[model samples]
Target: MGTPQTVLHVDDDPEMLALSTATFHQFDDISLLTATTAIDALDIVSSHSVDCVVSDSLMLPDGVPLIEALRRENKDVPIVLFTAKDWTEVADVASAAAVSEYVQKAGPDDLSTVLEHVGMLVDGDRDESLAAGVSAVTEALADHADAASAASFSLDENWELVGQWVGDDELGIVVVEAIEAHAGLPAIEEPLYDYIDADALEELLRPVLEDEERPGIEVRFPYGDFELAVTSTGDIFARPEPGETLY
Candidate 1:
């Protein structure tokens, strides 16, 4: 079997802890570690080789201090601030900007969203081909998407592509349509999060997203094969490379 992805979920409330357990229990590849407090979570993470951490924002010790404590202890695990509090009020994300993801409490599929971000951050490292620069997204996605409705954002006609943001659309659904329409022969089977860390992408776009007028922003990561960008208004963008497509 491949190596398992271990997640440490921390929350003070018993019910909250129960909900998180119920949420991630179905993933066969995930080894979930539950903690009721930041202190306990820290003790667990310090010893274990954990892949990711999901913590509530307003716990007894609070997430920011916990994050600070982890960094002080040199625990570099990616942290997702899962909270019932508004994203705006979450000072850690805006002030620290180190948390991997700060997700709002609203939305029908909140747990799924957390899982999506977790998966994006966990399975994020991959080799991508950066040969293409900017090219128009072909008619492939546009054609199939007519059945769905108008996209939240527009693509450059002559554009270098990586990946497109699905927005409210199913991430899996948008990725399939994008690959079927764009790639020359072999298709993109994995979701876009597999290409780049969505939490990182979110961190980049959060500042602009905070401004109502900004609507969207572009971000690029130099280390990867393709430059990565995300629009807070909606959707995700990544430069598509031939060799980078995962089976």
Candidate 2:
């Protein structure tokens, strides 16, 4: 690892900050920095070239406000909301701020999720490949405007099915189908509601895609064994969950 990825973790709790410091030590590629308040975090970000920011929702000024402030400092820096609060509590505000990812704090294992996202968001190697795949998928959709059903394309050797082009009316259906296809299930045996709230996902995505102000923003979430990346241009890409190998 040449220049290690710099990650700034913000939380008012000393225990949580210590926990994050210890957790990040497990990875050689990450250089972790801790800030107990949004002010210090912003200072750290402005001084250093931070790759990602992981913050708690219940900080002195709240996580979303910190995110907004960080956006002013650096518009494209990946910010992850690592909070113990329920997602519903901060989903709207976080979405509006364009948080790169959200991980609910549960057990110690949840820190691993935050680490995975940090790696995913900061990995420059993957960005080029993902951008290429998105471009191909967008062009394919443009070429086949008359198609009625969702079409899937392989993203890479690791991905089973990558891209789907469907209008807003069929986005949920295509997403469900993509998940089922990637998991090799005839149908989702578990309740569909158990995976993710389709309505909420659509609601979260509509404004991001429709808004001309925010360009090149993509919303990513874990869906079953796959991670779905919904782009600002109405393209969806699914691949194996981070750190998971598909057999």
lDDT of each: 0.53, 0.64
**Predicted model with the maximum TM-score:** 2
Best by lDDT: 2
Query: So what's the TM-score on candidate 2?
Result: 0.48
> Using Cα atoms with residue i matched to residue i, what is each candidate's TM-score against the true structure?
0.46, 0.48
Candidate 2 residues lying further than 4 Å off, grouped into runs, are 58-64, 124-247
- Model 1 spans > 4 angstroms off: 58-64, 92-97, 125-247
Ten residues in sequence with the least summed lDDT for candidate 1: 127-136
lDDT for 205 in candidate 1 is 42
Residues 146-207, candidate 1: write the lDDT tens digits. 31123323545423443344233444454345445444434544555666665555444422
lDDT of 2 by residue, 1-247 (tens): 4667889999876545644564565456678998878889888998999989998864335534777788778989899999888989889768866899999976545665676677789895644433433333333323332121122232446433333432435557766776676567763465446766866666654321121232344556677666776643345667778887767
